[model samples]
Target: MDEANRSDPPKWIQQHAVYQDLMHLDVGDSAQVYAFFLVYMDLTEGEEIAAVVGVSCPELQAVLLEGREKEGEPVQMIYPLPSHRSIKHRELRSILDRGAPMLLCAVASDSSLVYQTV
Candidate 1:
């Protein structure tokens, strides 16, 4: 695989708590399927412990394969981007600006395409 084509989730985010316990965690919508679910944050632990990233919207879409992509195994995401509205989004923006490593999530038309962080 090309170094740029790796789609491993960010190291920090754990599998969803329930999925972690169950071991077989899959995420899918009506037509497609995803085997992994990335956790972006543990908000209940409070802000000081969160892993944040300075990500742009286009960059995010790239992560999801809505933009450019690296070639390799198919990668599909069951969850779409969170709606960026309201005061909470403002705070999320601040976290990214601080240069924290965040679990950026996304999906592609083909599950086999390897998504990369440009």
Candidate 2:
């Protein structure tokens, strides 16, 4: 991985096999889209990777919130994603077209692509 393209996730996250695999994982472009969204997110809470209120897709909202409506959005705080199974953070960021907020497209364990929103 190039220095400019890779990011160091938290040590705890690095311990996870899923995270390790995703760091170098590759998936086909024709992946099935499970859900999509157009969310506004922030990394305020310590390790929680959450989107702001007004998430456009209710289905994606439900997945991220996971029935914790009042607790607030903290999807998961695995920082500096470096890259996802098929796309890199830089590429996603460019797609997002914003500097801070990111476009999150999580690959679920079932091999489905989730939370792909712009």
Candidate 3:
């Protein structure tokens, strides 16, 4: 399998309680979880975002429901981005500013797509 597509959470995330609970969740795949954050944060619409992530809208919706049921209000803690432009940088800044765990997925310079918790 491609390294970028690997499903395992990073070492630090596995050691962190909040991220551990999230990683253990049977919420589709890691990409779906990232899609959930994108949708939940209102960064993008669910259908389009789901398509971009290669997950069906229903599947993404189910993941959202599962996260809500399992993580409760904490699942809704994503910081909203002010704009889609420079979204990744904005998201990283928001995550750092809040000092909270966040799901992030992106295409690297070498064209590898990666998804992980930060």
Among these predictions, the greatest lDDT belongs to 3
Q: What is candidate 1's lDDT per residue for 22-109, written digit by digit as tens?
A: 2322222212112122212322133322232212233222221121122342332222232221124654454355443333333343
Considering every candidate listed, which one attains the maximal TM-score? 3
- Better structure of 1 and 3 per lDDT: 3
Candidate 2: C-alpha RMSD after superposition? 12.6
Candidate 2 Cα errors over 4 Å, as ranges: 1-32, 35-84, 103-105, 111-118
Ranking by lDDT: 3, 2, 1
In terms of lDDT, model 2 sits at 0.31
Model 3: number of clashes? 0
- The local distance difference test score of each candidate is 0.29, 0.31, 0.38
Which lDDT value does model 1 have at 107? Answer: 34
Task: State every prediction's TM-score relative to the real structure.
Answer: 0.21, 0.23, 0.28
Cα lDDT of model 3 by residue, 10-69, tens digit:
466457554345445654445444434444433333331221221122322223311221
Q: List the residue pairs that clash in candidate 1.
A: 52-100, 53-96, 54-96, 64-106, 73-112, 74-111, 74-112, 74-113, 75-111
- Residues 4-99 of candidate 2: C-alpha lDDT, one tens digit per residue: 443443476556554344333332111211121111122224223333332222222222211121365433311122123454455544434422
**How well does candidate 2 score on lDDT at residue 81?**
23
- Count of backbone collisions within predicted model 2: 1
Off by over 4 Å in 1: 1-99, 112-118
